[model samples]
Target chain A: MANTGSNQVPTADVASVASSPRPYLPGDLAMWFFILAELTVFAIFIIGFAVTRQLYPDMFQQGQTYLHPVAGGINTIALISSSCLVALSLNAIKHSRQNYAAALLGGALLTASVYLAVKSWEYNELIQQGFGLSTNTYFTLYFFITAFHFMHVILGMIILGSMAFKTTKGAYQGKSLSGFESGACYWHMVDLVWIIIFPLLYVIN
Target chain B: MKPFGKMEYCWWTLIGITLFNTFLGEQFSSSALVSILVALTVMFKGLMIIDHFMELRHAHRYLRLMMRAYLIFFPSLIIVTTFL
Candidate 1:
């Protein structure tokens, strides 16, 4: 394999590629922009939640009382731990340690499963208590935000799981860190969103 | 070419810190101060994810700049809209 001085292709080729206006690579600038747009959408929802909370602080507080902070906190730990595993997996890929990467990815996947299980338990408890999405505006927003995050977590898991499979198959043998890098970036975004959501919804009361 | 050294230590340290903060945040709801502290802890966790996990520390300068901008602008926009 040719050792390019930097990870990026040479400047001359970059200029030519830029001048042609070719589409960015998958998981490139456009993808990042798409992620940013998604982030903006979630931010708007959060702002809406904040405004509603400001308007009816007591009801929002009451809604918080119904939430299981211990469970929520446990979920936070789970996600954080999963994020760490994903990060370690990427590091393993970088070092060409395929087996280590596979192991880390397995750990991450397990953590995701645990996250879903805990979330299911929490949802079950809330549903039993008649505090579901239809319960109130706060519950509505709560479910919406968390459900959106859950979808991302599932997607991240799929992506990481696929990467893990490929790693075991020697797909990333040399000079291809993009797959792991992209997965890490995506998983970090997943973890970051949870960090914001946990504080805004659970701890701030 | 592992992006980070001390992988196991870093991973466990971050997990420990997050769990500690989460427990403290949930158990004691005496003041907003605790909430802020918890948020800061989460923020630190985020920094670790970006720097070590995402290998942003090893990323190109332009990419790093873009990520930093996104992190700042998105949250700031939300906070401002909340007040408005």
Candidate 2:
């Protein structure tokens, strides 16, 4: 049979559909899935800790007494400030303000350094008090969670520093801002995680 | 793009709020309540980051729907498993 107009969908409509912006590209979706999986893993750890705390309220309270809230509070501010700097850097890049972008990255690096310094001080204090990873269940959880977060902070600083270097070298000038964008997203996620951990681990008791 | 500065201001405001909450949390004696409040603050911050910083606010409707689906569904599952 001869092809009829009634049987044919419009090519323009098909083209429009194909050209429409998808909710996520393959890479973005994959990255989001990876983050979700990582979040679930941390959730499991949180739930386990909650259950244990329920079982040993007194011990957990005692554990809380040993934590320094001042240090924890400082670290919270540091992470939040770092997130702000990264975000500002992303905005500056979008605006083609290379100098400002570099400045923001420098700010982020400085904040990360402060965070690490305070963290080391806290760790040293804890160690001096004999509260290592092997100390007890509470200490184990504390050390593991904070250590994992510290590693992320270090990673985020490296990413920010690299982006700064690229900006100075005139990279990311015309391309889509996806690289800096994703790095900022990941850094915010790191900050978000620490926000939860701050209260749960230190201030809660 | 037009409201980029506004978005930045909002995010900075959120950071300020979170810092305030952090200070308040340090003063609270009840761990559970403090933890709950802190969680809520962080959730708000997360929403701001996703909506503004990630540029998801200007995304297509279907994409927003999908995001809402993920946000609601996964947390629900976790809560169900934890409670029941």
Candidate 3:
């Protein structure tokens, strides 16, 4: 573990301060602030979706019926499984198991790839069936929400890709885990948003 | 602190619950009972990810509270506006 002390502090003071419990936020506080802001915007979007659904019940229901719930469900599992691998990767790094951590991060990247591929397939099908964003209010909202989320997934994959590389280099060990945790936090937020999105756009009628 | 052993278990549990929620939604699409159940399931899944996957279980009190609020507020809004 890296010493949780400043060079100016004496050795005895450093030891005592390290032993004392202090509340700490995971990752960078700035990252947490970013996450909170991101979530707030998503919440607004979801609320707007709900309100629109209320106004156009028949159109929303009809649009939802055309969607493939099974595809959405499969993607849900993929993202959640990827999230598990990300969390497990952090666990491995915490134990200084660099190879294991790299392997787990690799697994997470694969699962994320699966999610993107499945999403692409779904989008292809939608377009092939002539369901463009201008199809209707429901399709507009659906395409917008999902495509926006799709971008986030891609961004997350990029972050995980770098983290995996760093893990193989043994860069994130012990007190150096905040970067890894921050990446995981962002990935989990993607999964969290999808958890609600899947049901809202796919399952609910 | 079994050091990550429990995480895989939590992962599987999340998968099982999510699958179960999908099953409920499919079986009872028009049932008010299922709507409430589905909303609750979404909230539960979000909480699990925030607490376990995100490690908010060890986070500061304000952070934990903020997450809790997000988990509750959004799902409740969805249920009220859509189901009711």
Top lDDT hit: 3
Runs with alpha carbons beyond 4 Å of true place in candidate 1: A1-27, B1-6, B69-84
- Tens-place lDDT digits, model 1, residues A1-205: 2222333332222224234433323134444565667777877887788788777877888888777777777787788778888877765665668899899899989988888999889888889988878878889999999999899999989988898898899887765455456666788788877867876787665
For TM-score, the strongest prediction is: 3
Candidate 3 lDDT, B1-84, residue by residue in tens: 235666777788878877877776566565566666778888998989988888777567798899989888877876686446
Instruction: Name the 10 consecutive residues with the lowest summed lDDT in model 2 chain A.
Output: A6-15
Positional deviation of residue A125's Cα in model 2 after best superposition, in angstroms: 0.7
Compared with the true structure, what per-residue lDDT tens digits does model 2 show for residues B1-84? 223566568557776865666576567776445555555565566566656544556454664565545444433333343332
As for candidate 1, its clashing pairs are none
Weakest ten-residue segment in model 1 chain A by summed lDDT: A3-12
In model 1, the Cα lDDT at residue A16 comes to 41
Clash pairs for candidate 2? none
Query: Alpha-carbon error at A63 in model 1, in Å?
Result: 0.9
Tens digits of lDDT, candidate 3, A28-130: 6767887888888888878888989989999998888777777788889999999999988776666567898799989988988998999999999989999
Better of 1 and 2 by TM-score: 1
